[model samples]
Target: MKIKLSRIDDRLIHGQVATVWAKEAGAGRIIVVSQEVSEDDIRKTLVKQAAPPGIKVNIVDPEKAVKVYNNAKYADETVFYLFTNPMEVVTMIEAGIPIQSINIGGMQFKTGRTQVTKAVSVDETEVAAFRKLAEMGVELDLRVVATDPKGDFEGKLKEAGL
Candidate 1:
């Protein structure tokens, strides 16, 4: 399978994603790689409904994603992967998925998380996961939208002293 874009956005299929990023990626399919969301029937339905017209959306757990990604049956499909956090990306890469880079879209602020950017927030565990991905040579491209200039995720991490 060809991966067009792998983005980390907690909101999953929203305005920016359903309209902008999917079109920008030129992907025929958008797969939401999240164990939590995949298991929730409501979320799966909602994500599917929110997908852009003429595009397909699949919500699969990380394990299923690995299998689906490596399957020869899907070799012709161009996919855009969406995730809620960095650790999910790490899981895929560690499972031999060969993800070269990931777009950091939005990681909304929560209690106990420090703001890394206007749209991104992270805690200790998230910081370590991001560091691990960097160590593994995965480029962390920070951009809120396709038109927005890419921000330096590494520099943001450093600035936050993460």
Candidate 2:
């Protein structure tokens, strides 16, 4: 799958993700993978309404995302995959989904989440999951804005005392 972007943004589907992100990335479709959004009929409808004027928003459960990931035939599709939390990716990886690179973008400010940089934060469990993902050959990165590129999350974790 030619995943344009894989992001961990807590809100899952928002305006920036719908319009600004889609336009800037030139993505044809967006897939927001989450356990909560996929199962909620109301939320799914609302997100679809909020999507960009032309592009499609595919709201799918993590399990179903596995199928989509495996079956997608669009080599240059420029589709994006997003999850509400980093742990969701961890869960998916443990379930045997293959992920390429991911960016930590919009997790909320929380206590004990030591700021590794402006965009990424971590405590203990997240660190463990990240480590496990790294062991599995999944590349992780941190980036704040569209213009700015990403940095290695493993190095950031080291600086954050992980």
Candidate 3:
């Protein structure tokens, strides 16, 4: 499958992603590659239901995503990947999914997490995973929507003293 855009958003299939980012990426399919979400029937169902008309949604674990990506089963499909955290992105990448860049969209406020951008919050573990991804040549695009100016995610992490 061709990766149009990869994003780490806690709200997986929200308004901005369902409309703005999806349109910008021209994605035919949204692949929510998160083990936790995939196993949660209610969340998985809700995410699938939230997709824009004409776009397919696939909720799968990192392992299944890697297999589908490597097998070229969706070679003709333009896929936009969504993950909840940077660590899951790392997992998928290490499992052989060829992700070159990732959009740090939304990481909800939580205890012990430092706010990097207004919409992004990260903790020590996430910062480490993001650093690892950057070290592996993955560009991190920090943007809230298609209209927002993209910022440097790693730089923001550093600025936050991560």
Ranking of candidates on lDDT, top first: 1, 3, 2
By TM-score: ranked, best first: 1, 3, 2
Q: What is the TM-score (0 to 1) of candidate 2?
A: 0.78
Instruction: Tell me each candidate's RMSD, in Å, in order.
Output: 0.8, 2.9, 1.1
Q: Local error of candidate 3 at 133, Å?
A: 0.5
lDDT of each structure? 0.94, 0.76, 0.90
Candidate 3 wrongly placed segments (more than 4 Å): none
Candidate 1 lDDT over 112-152, as tens digits, reads 99999999999999899999999999999999998888898
Best by TM-score: 1
- Candidate 1 ranges with C-alpha deviation above 4 Å: none
List model 2 lDDT by residue over 60-121, tens digit each: 98888877767747555667788877777887787766677777777765898888776566
Question: Which of candidates 2 and 3 is the stronger one according to TM-score?
Answer: 3
lDDT of 3 by residue, 77-127 (tens): 889999999999999888878899999889999899999988999999999
Candidate 2: what lDDT?
A: 0.76
- Model 3 is weakest, by summed lDDT over 10 consecutive residues, at 68-77
